[model samples]
Target: MATEAPKRSRFKRTLITMFKVGLYGSLLGLIALVVAVGIAMSQLPTYQELVRRDNLGQMIRVRAADGSTLVSLGPSFGRWLTSDQIPEIMKKAMVAVEDRRFYYHPGVDPVGIARGIQVSFQKDDKVRGVSTISQQLARNIFLTSDRSYGRKVREGILALALERKFSKEQILELYLNRVYFGGGAYGIDAASRRFFGHSADTLSLAEAAIIAGLVKAPSNYSPTADAEAARSRASVVIELMRKNGEITGSEAFAAEPADVRIVPTPKQNSVRYFTDWVLPQLDTLIEENIEPIEVWTTLDPNMQRLADQVINANTPAGAQGALVALDRDGSIRAMVGGRDYVRSIYNRATQANRQPGSSFKLFVYLSALEFGYKPDSMVEDKPITIGSWSPRNNNRGFAGAVPLRQAFAQSINTVSVRLAQEVGFRTVADMAQRFGVTTKVSTHPSMALGSSEVRLIDMTRAFAAVAAKGVAVVPYGIRRVTTAEGELLYQHESDESRVLVAPHVAAQMTDLMQAAVLTGTGRAAQIGRPVAGKTGTTSSNKDGWFLGFSSGLTTGVWMGRDDNKAIPGLQGGRAPAQAFHDFMSRAVASRPVEQFETQVAPPDWAETEPDEEVWYDSPSNQGQMVDADGNPIAPPPAGEAPLTQTEDPRRPQQEETLEDLVERAIDPERRERPQVPPRPAERAPPPRDRGSAGDPVERRSPTPQP
Candidate 1:
C-alpha cells in the first residue's frame, strides 16, 4: 500500500509540471502574435501611400498670347513655391510652434515621442504626434488626411524611409515647399509672394511674421478680407519668433504691422466673347503639335471701351448689351460680350440667340430687290393677320398705300409681312442661311418679320454681305495666326462666296439704306460720312438692335436684358443706334475712307411717279390725311395752293462727264446747297434763264434701264 501511494504522488507531480509548461508556451505564442500584428500595422499605410501618388494632382497654367502667365490652377488649391526664398522669420516661427528640435530629429523626435506617450496614457486621448518636419511632409504630400492609429503608424514608417533617402536640409526644404499655407499657396515662397506681393528673399520682418501666422489657419488670417484678424495672428508669430531667437525681444516689439502691399491682380477678362466665337474657327485653321495655342485677336481696345461706355450710357441698369465690329473685309475688330463680362460668362454676342426684329427687314428688302422687285414697287401697308399672329406698325397706324422704298425706310410691319408672303418665307430664310445665318429659322410665315432667333455674329456676317457688295465673306479675327518666331501657322484666306443679289442690286439696296439714314428710323446712326444701316426692334420691346457700316468699318449693336424681359418703349433707334454711331466714329478714327459704289437714279426715274407721296399731313388732322373712303391723298395744301414741283436748273444733267458725276456724288450735301458739279473746260454749259423751258426738257431714253 505504501509503494502504490508513492507511485500515485509521483504521477500527480509530473502532470502538474506538464500543465505549467503548456501555459507558458501559449503565453509566448500570444506575445509573438501581438508583436507581428504591430509591425504589419506600421507597414500597411506606407504601402498604401505609395500607391496613392500615381494620380497626384497636376497644375494647369493659363497664359496670354504673348506667353505671359495669367494664372495657374494648383493641386489642393496650393501653388508650389521654392524653399530657398522662404523668409527666416517664418521658418523660425514654424520651428517654435511645431517642433523645437526639428533640425536635430531624424524623422521622429525621441523626446517628443516620449512626451506624447506619457500624454496619451495620462489624458486617455489617442492624440499623440512626435512628428518631425519630414514626417509632417510625408503625411501632407503622400497620405490621405485621416486621423487614425493606422495612419499615424504608416506616417512614421514613411517618415523613416524619407529621412533615410533624403538629407535633413532636403526634407526641411520639401516640407516648406509642399506644405499648405492656405489661399492655394503650397510653399512658403508662393505664400510670401501671394500675401506680400514680394519674393521670400525680399520679405520684411513683419511680412514674414504675418505669413508664418497663416501656417496654422489661413482663413482666420486672410490679409485681404480680414486685416484685423491677420494682424492679431501676425502678433502671435512675432512672439514665437522672439522666443526662438529668430529676432530679439526688442526687434520683435519694434516691428510694425505688416505693410503687406498686396499687388492687386487685374480682373481675368478672358476675352470671353471673342474667344468663344473664335475657338471653333481656330480649330479648323490649326493642326499638329497643337498645345493650347494663344490667340491674339484683332479687337481694338479703344473700340471695345467705347462700345461699353455707349451701352452703359444708353441701356437701363441691369440690362445687357453686345457690340461686334468688323472690318469691311470681314475681320472681327471689336466685340463686347456683355456690359459686365465677369457677372455672366455666357457670351451673348456669340452664344445667345435673340430675335432680330425689324433689323431683319433688310434681308426682306434685299430678297425682293433680287427677285425683280424694285424700290418703287407699290405694296399696301394695311392690317395683317396671318394664322394666330398679328403684326402692328411701330406708330400703331398703317400707311394706306406705300412704295417699298418708303415702307422699308419707316420699318412698316404690315408692308414687311406683305412682302414676306409675296416672296415666300422659305426664300428669305434660305437667303439668310446662304449669308451664314445658320440659326434655325422658323418655316412659319411670321419668320419673315424675324420671329426666329439669330446670333449677333451671324447677323454681323449677314451685314458683311451688304458691306462687301453681295459677297458672303466668312468673318475672321486672326489675319495670320503665327508662332513666336513669326512663322505662318495659319493664313486667313478670304472665302468670298457670291450668295444673293447682283452688285448693282446690292448698290441699290445701299442707296435705300442711305435714305434710311437721311430720313428713316435709322437716322440716329448717321455719321458725317456716308453710312448705311438698318434699325431693329422686336415685339414687346424685348430686343433693340442697330447694325450699320461706315465707308471703312461695319458694326452691329444689341441692347436687351439677359432674362428676355421687355424694356417697354425702348426702340432700336434709341440706345443701340447711338452706340453704333459712337463705336464706328471711334473705330474709324485712323482708317482711311473706302469708297462704295453709289446708286444713281436713271435719267428716266424723274418722269416715273414718286414711289409714295411724302404728304405733310397737318398735325390737326389727328389720324391721317385721307380721302372720304380712308385713302391717302397727294402731298399739297387743301386750298391755298397745291404747290408746284419745280425742276432745279442747277441740277447737273446725266450727260455730264464722269468727273462731274464723281464730284457730285463725292459731296452730296453740296447738291442740296447752291453748288453744281464743275463742267469740263472744253465743253462748258451755257448760262440758262431760270424761266425758259420749265415744263419737260427731256432727252431720249438710254436704251431701257434695268
Candidate 2:
C-alpha cells in the first residue's frame, strides 16, 4: 500500500512539470506576436488621415466632339453614401458573400482561417483566401497588393486598428465606398450606376448580388465583360445570402439572372479603343496635375458607331478587322480597333504593325510623281529580276506595256519595283516618312511591294495628307482638354504651311487613285461620289488593307489574323475595300457631293522651293538617262543593253514633249472615269462576287537578304 502511494505522487509531479513548460512557451509566443504587431502598427497611416483622404487617383473623362461621354480612363468614383443611404440588400449581400462574421469577429476570423487552412490541405496545398471584410478594407485603403508573410502581418495589424477605430457600420461603409469594381469603377455607388444605370438606392436584389460577387474578381465577374458568367456568380452570391438568412428562399428564387439588366459600361463600348489611344497623349499635352480633367476628343459618335457596325459585319470568322477614319484636318473621326473591344482591348488600328502590301504604293507612286513621271508614262509590266529576286504580277502574266495609271491601278508588282528602282529606294522611304508614316521604312527592293510593316493609323494619316491636298496631316484625337471647373488646359492647333507633298503632285496622285477606284482593284470601294483608294493584299493573304478618301474624310481598313497566319483567299479588295465603301457611303450622305480638284495650285510656301530632286530617265529616251541636274547622258554603245529596259514600243510618229505628255495625262478624256450607276438612298447590296477576276492580289516577293 505504501509503495503505491509514492508511485502516484511521482506521476503527479511529472504531469505538473510538462504543464509548466507548455505555459511558458505559449506566453513567449504571445509576447513575440504582440511585439510584431506593434511594429506593423507603427508603420501604418493614422485613422484620421485615412478617413479624410480623397482623390483616390487622377481620373480622365473623355467626351466625343458632340459632347457625349466616350469613356473614363482611370479610377471612377460616384458620390459617397452614408450607412443609411446604402441599400439594405446591397449591405446584406456584401456581408453574406464577403464576410459572414463581420460583426462577430474582432478583425480577423479564426474560424474562417482554420477553414481556409483545411481547404488548402484538402486541395493539394492551393492556398485559399481567408480575408474578412475588415482585412480587405485594410488592404484596399493602406496597402499594396503584395502577397507576402510580412505584408500579411502588416495587413492584419491594420485591420485590427481599423476595427478598433470604427464601428461595424462605419467599416462596412468605408469598404463599400472604396472597393474596386471592374471597368474603372470604384465604390458600390459607382458600380451600381455603372452596371444598372441607377443609383445604389435603387438596386434590385439580383443587382445587389451581382455587384457583391464582383468583389472577389472584378474583371472576371464584371457583367459588362461576360453577362452569363456574371449571372452564374451572382446566383452563387444569392444562395449565400439565402443560407445566411438575409433573404428568404422565395426572395432568392425571385432574384433571377433575367431580372438583372446590365447597362453597357464604358469599357464595353467600342470607343474605349479611341479613348485608350488618346489617354497617353494627355501627359504630353497638359501639365501633370492631380485634379480630374475632361478631354474633348474629335470622335464623331455617329461615325464611330457606323465603323463598329461595319467592322463587325465584314470581319470574317477567325480574323480581325480595324478601321481608322480621319477628317481633312487630321482629326480622328472614328476608330474601331477590332470587331469586339470586350473580347480584345489591343488596339489593332494604332498598335498593330503589318505589311501594307499595295496600300504602301502610295509612297512609291508619290515618289514617282515627284521624280517627274506622268500617270500616262508607259512602263514595262513584264517579269523583272533584282539581285536573285524575281517579282511577277499577281496574275503571273505580264501586260507588255502599260501606262503608269493602269499599272498603279492594277497593283502590278513589277511596275512598282521598277519605279522604286528608278526613283532611288531611299527617296521612296523618305517620301513615306514625310507623309507621317512613323514606322521605320526599309530601302530594300521588296519594300516597294510593302514588305516593311506599318501601323494602320500612320497609313490612314498619309492618306489624309492626300485628302488634305498635300498639307501635312498630323492625326490627333483630343481637340481640347479642360479641368472639371472649365479651366482650359490644352487645345489643338495646326500649322497650315507645313506642306507634305506638292499640290500638283497630290492632285496627280489623286487622279491615279481615282482611276484605281474606277477601273482597278479597288472597284469594290466605289461610292456614288468621287472616291480614290488603293487595295493591298500581303504575302499568303496574311494582311489585307484599303486606304481611301472622299469628301474631306479619309479612312483606312485592315483585315488579318492576329497570329499572322494566312486567312485563306483574303484580299484587300474583297473585304477591306467593301467595308470602306459601306462606311463611307453613309458617312458622306449628309454632306453635298464634292469633286476632287484636278488642278490644284501649289501653296505659296511650296511655290518657291523645288518639291524634290528629280531623277527622270524617260523610258522613251532610247537608252539615254538624265542626271540629277537634268543633264542628258550619252546612250550606251550599240549592242550594249541597260541593266533594265522597257520593251521597245512602236516608235511614236512624232516624239511628244514631257509637257505634252503631262497635259494629256491630266486631260479628263484620257483618265478612265468610273461608270456611274444611279444613286440609291441606302447602300447598295455588296456584290456577291467581291473576289472577281479584277480584284488585285498583291503577290509576295522573296525578300533578298542585305
Candidate 3:
C-alpha cells in the first residue's frame, strides 16, 4: 500500500511540473505579444503628416480647355491645411463631439472606454466608439478596418506611443491628416480643396464646422452633390456639440439653420447630340488618369440650333430625329441628336440604328458602274420573281422597257432587286462595305431594298467618301490639346483610307446622285449648287433618311420615333431634306465651294448601239477561245449546260439571255440617277354609249407628208 502511495506521489509531482512549465510558456507568449505590439507602435510616422492627410478641408475643380468650370470636387476629398487654419469653434466642436477629454488624456480616456462598453452591451450592437484623436490617428496610419481583439490591442499600444512621441497639437494634426473623409480623399487638405475649392487655412466658421461634421461619414455629408443630406448630418454634429458643452443652446440653435451654399457643378456639356458616338472613340486618344476632360467639339452651336429649328418645324409633334454634319476634311462640325436633350439622352444620331431604305440603292448602282454597266443602258423595269420571292415596282406594274438611269431615278424596286441579284450579292456587299457601311448587311435580294441598319455618323462618313472622290476619311473631333504653358500635348489628323471606286468612278456616282436631286427621288435635296444625295423613305413611313454631300461637307439626317413605331405620313424628302438644307446653307454659307468632278473614261458600253453585240470577260473563264459560230475550240466541260446559238434576224445573233443582260447591267451597282419606284399607271374610263355617236367621227391617221 505504501509503494502504491509513492507511485501516486510521483504521478502527482510530474503533473505539477507540467503545469509550471505551461504557465511559464504562457507568460513568455504574453510578453512576446506585448513586445511585438510595442515594436509595431514605435514605427508610426510623424503625427503632423497624418493630420495633414486626414483633415476634411479641400476642393477639386475640373475645367474645359477654355477654362470653364465643368465640375468641382468638394471637402470630403479635402485640401490639406493646418489646425490653426480652421475656426476655433470648428476645432472645439470636433474635439467635444469626438473626444471631450482629448487635451487632458494622454491618448485614451478610461471613462469614455467604459461608457462605450456599457452602451455597446445595452444596445446589443457595437454602436458606441470611444476612440480618442490619438487612437484614431494610430488606426488610420497603421491599421485596417478590422475590429478584432488583437486589432484593439494594437490600436491601444500605438495610441500610447503616439502620445509619447508628439505633442497634443502635433497628434491632432496627424489625426486630421490620416482620417479618411471619403470620395478617395485621404487628408483634410485634399478634402477641403475637393469640396470647398480653397486651402484649409482660409476656411470660414460655417465651412470649417461643416467639414468637421463630415468625420462621421463623408458621403452622407457631401455638401456639393447632396446638400440636404449634408445639412442633416451637420445638425447631428451640432446636437453633439451642444450636448458636449462645446456650444451653447443659442449657438446650437443658430447652427441648426442649415443654410449651405453648395458650389454649382459645371454642366456635363451634355453632348446630347454626338457625344455618345464620340465617347467610344476616345479610349485610343487620351492618356489614363487625366480625367474629367472637357471636349470642346467642332460643333457650331448656332448650326445645331438651326438644325433643331428646321426639324421641329417640319416633323410631327411627337417624332424624333437626328442630324450629323461633317466638314470637308470629315471633321464633325455640328450634330443634333434629338429634339430635346433632357427628354432622351439617347443620341439618335449615334445610337439609333434604322434602315436606309431607297437611300441604300446608291451603293447598288455604284457596284453596277464598276461592272461595265452604263447609266443609260436599257433594262426591263417589270415585276420579277426569284426563288418565289417576287418584288413589285413602286408603280405596281411593269414599265416594259426603260433606261436604267430612268428606272433608278424612279426608285423602281423590281429593277433594284433584279439588279442586285445580277450584280453578284458579294460584289454589292463589298461596295457597301467599302463605302463605310460597317453594319452586317442582309445577303438576301431584299438587301438591295435597304433592309439593313446604319448609324448617322457611319452614313455621313460614307457619303464623305464620295465627296472626297473615293478617299474615305474617319470623322474625328479632337484637333489639339496643349498644356497651360502652350506646350503641345496632343495633335490628331484624319485617319484616311481609300474604300470605293476610283476618282472617275466616284464622279460618276456623284453625277447620278446629283441627278437624283435635280429630277429624281432626291429633288428635295437640291441646294442650288452641284449637290449629290439620296432620300430614303422606309416602309410604313417608319424612318426618313437623307444623306447628301457638297464640295466641302457631307451631312446625314434621320427622322423617326424612339419606340420604333411608324411615323405617320412622314417621308425622307420632307423633314429630313429640309433639315439637311438648313444645316448645309449655314454650314457652307462662308466657304468657297467646288463642283463635283465628272467621269473621265468612257463607260464600257457607252458608245455601243443597243442592237450591237459586245464581247465581255468572265471572271472564271479567261482567254478561252469560243467563237460566235459555236465552233468549240475544246469540247464543253461534261455535265455543263450546253451553249446553244439562237438566230435573231432583226439584228445580230442573241448570245445573252434577259437574265444575263439584267445581271450585266447590275454587276457594279453604281448609278447615274437615284433609283425610285415606278409611277403606277392610271386606268382610263371606258367609252360611254354617247361615245357611239362620237365614234362615227373617229379621226383618220394623216398620210405621210413626203
Candidate 4:
C-alpha cells in the first residue's frame, strides 16, 4: 500500500508540471499575437484613404491629343449618398441577409465567424463568405479579397478600427456606395438607376431586397439575366428579415418572387472601340496609387468622322472594313475600327489579321533594290515554276522581260516571284522583318503573293516607315498621361529606327509607287497630288487592300468579310481605292499640296539612266545553289550566266554612296526636277487651297456618331 501511494504521488507531480508548461506557452502565444496585430494596425492606411475615396467615384478620362475628351472610363456616375438619404428598407435588407446581429456586437461577429468556419470546412456547395457588414466594408475598401486566415484577421482588425474611427451610420453609407453591382454599375444609386430606373431613396421593399441580395454574387443573380434567380435570392433575404424581426410576417408574405420591373442598361458611348483598345495600354502606364488619370491620345476627331463617312458611303452592307491612318512620326491620326462600337467592340483596325495580298510586293521590291538591283533592272516575266508551286499574275498573262519599275507598277506576280528567287527568299524575308512586319513569314514561293496573314496596324506602321524616309516607326495612340491633379504620370516617346530602305532605294521605290497611283491598278486613288501606294487583292477576292502614303500621312484600308469568305467583284483597285481617295481628299483638303520628298523625274521612258546597271560576280564554289526554301537550283540555263561586274564606260568612275545616288537621281542640278529638302514632318507644308485634277465631289451629309 505504501509503494502504491508513492507511485501515485509521482504521477500527480508529473501532471502538475505538464499543466504549468502548457499554461505558460499559451500565455506567450497570446502576447505574440497581440504584438503582430499591433504592427499590422500600425501600418494600416490612415482615415484619409477612406475620406478621399479617389478610386471609388472618380473617372479616368481618355482625351484626344488636343485635350478633347474621347471617352471616360472607371467607376459609376453616382454621387455619394449620406445615411439619411438611404431608405430604411435598404438598411434592413442588407443587415438581414448579411448579418442578423449587426448592431448588437462589435465589428467582428463571433457567431457568424463560427458558422462560416463550420460551413466552409463541410459544404456541398463552394465555400461562401459569412462576413458582417463592417468586415465586408473593411475587405472591400482597405484590403484585397484574399482567402487566407491572415487576411481574415487583418479584416477583423481593420473593421474594429473603422468602427472606432467612424459612426455605424457612416460605415453603412460608405458600404452602400463602394459595392459593385452587375453590368458595370456601382453604388446603390447606379444600381437603382440601372435596375429600377429610379433613385435609391425611392426603392420599394421588393426592389431593396433584390438589390441587397445582389451583394453576395451580383453576376449570378443579375436581374437583367435570370430574374428567377434574382427573385429567388430576394425571397431568401425576405425570409431572413422576418426571422430577425426586422419585417412583419405580412410584409414578408407580400414580397413574393415575382418579376420586378427592370430598366434596360444604357449602352456605352461610340468611343467604346477606342476606349477598349486603349485600356490595356492605359493600365500598363498607371498604377493603383494614382487618382483618376487623363490620357492624351493622337486621335483626330475630324479625320475620324471623315473616315467613317468615306467607309460607310461605299462599303457593302454586311461586310466589315477597317482603316488606319498615321502621321510620318507614327502617331495614329485617325482610326475607324468598325461600323459601330456598341454592336462590336472588336477593333478590326488593331485586331484583325488579314492577308496583305499583292500589297506585300512593296517589301519584295524594296528587297530587290537592296540586293543591288536598280529600278530599271529587267527580269523575264515568263512562266516559271519552283518545285511544285507556280504563281500567275492577276492578268493571267505575263509582260515578258519587263523592267522592275513597270513590273512593280503593274503588280506582276511572275516578276515579283522571279525577283524573290534571284535575291534569295531569305533576303526578302529579312527585309520584310526590317520593315516591321512581325507576322511569322513562310518561305514558301506563295509568300511573294502575300499568302501569310498580317495585322493592319502592323502594315500601317511599316508603310509609315517609308514615309519617314527609310526609318521604321511604331504606330502609337497615347501621347501622354496626366492625373486629375495635373501631375505627369507617363509620356510616350516615338519608337523610330533606321531600316533596310536606303535613300536610293527609297527614292526609286517612291517613283515606281507613284506611277502605280498615276496609271497602274491604283489609278482609282488618284488625288492629283504626289503619292505612292500599292493595291492588293487576295484569292477569290476574299481580302482587298489599298496601302498608300503621301508626304504627310500614311493610310491603309482593308475591305473584306470578317469570316474570311469571298466577296465577289471586290478588288483593291475599286472600293478600297475609292475609300482611300475619299478619306485622303478630305483629310488633306485643309492642308497644302506637298510632293514626295524623293520624287525622281517622272521616269524617262525614252531611255534608261546611265547608272541603271547592276552587277554580281560568281564564286567558283557557288555550284550547289539552293533557293531560300531549301530547293536545289540548276545553274543559269544558257545566256543566264552571271553578269560582269563593270561600271559604265561613258559615266565617271566614282564610288558613290546611296545618298549620293538619290541626290543625283532627284536633285535639280543633276536632274530636271526640283529638289525638296526632307522635312521632319509633312505638316511643314503651310495650310492652303489646292485644286484637284478631277471633278470636285460634293461633300455628303455627315452621319450620326455611332
Each candidate: what lDDT? Answer: 0.66, 0.80, 0.66, 0.73
lDDT of 1 by residue, 237-256 (tens): 77877777778988988887
- Which residue window of length 10 is worst by lDDT in model 4? 697-706
lDDT of 4 at 499: 58
lDDT of 3 by residue, 335-381 (tens): 77887776778787777788888888888887766654556566656
Better of 1 and 3 by TM-score: 1
Residue lDDT tens for model 4, 33-102:
5675566567656654664566665567788767876766676446667789999999999989887777
Model 2 sits at a Cα RMSD from the real structure of 12.5
Model 1 vs. true fold: TM: 0.65
- In terms of TM-score, the best-performing candidate is 2
Candidate with maximal lDDT: 2
After superposition, candidate 2 runs with Cα above 4 Å error: 1-74, 95-136, 143-164, 181-184, 213-258, 264-296, 312-320, 336-361, 371-426, 439-455, 480-490, 537-544, 559-573, 601-706
Please give the lDDT score for candidate 2.
Answer: 0.80
Model 2 C-alpha lDDT per residue in residues 341-399, reported as the tens digit of each score: 87899999999999999999999998877655667676677766665577778898999
Q: Which regions of candidate 3 fall more than 4 Å away from where they truly are? A: 1-38, 41-116, 123-203, 223-225, 235-259, 264-353, 372-387, 390-415, 418-422, 475-493, 497-499, 512-532, 549-555, 558-563, 574-656, 659-706
Q: TM-scores, in order shown?
A: 0.65, 0.67, 0.64, 0.59
Candidate 1 structure lDDT: 0.66
Looking at model 4, residue 233 earns an lDDT score of 91
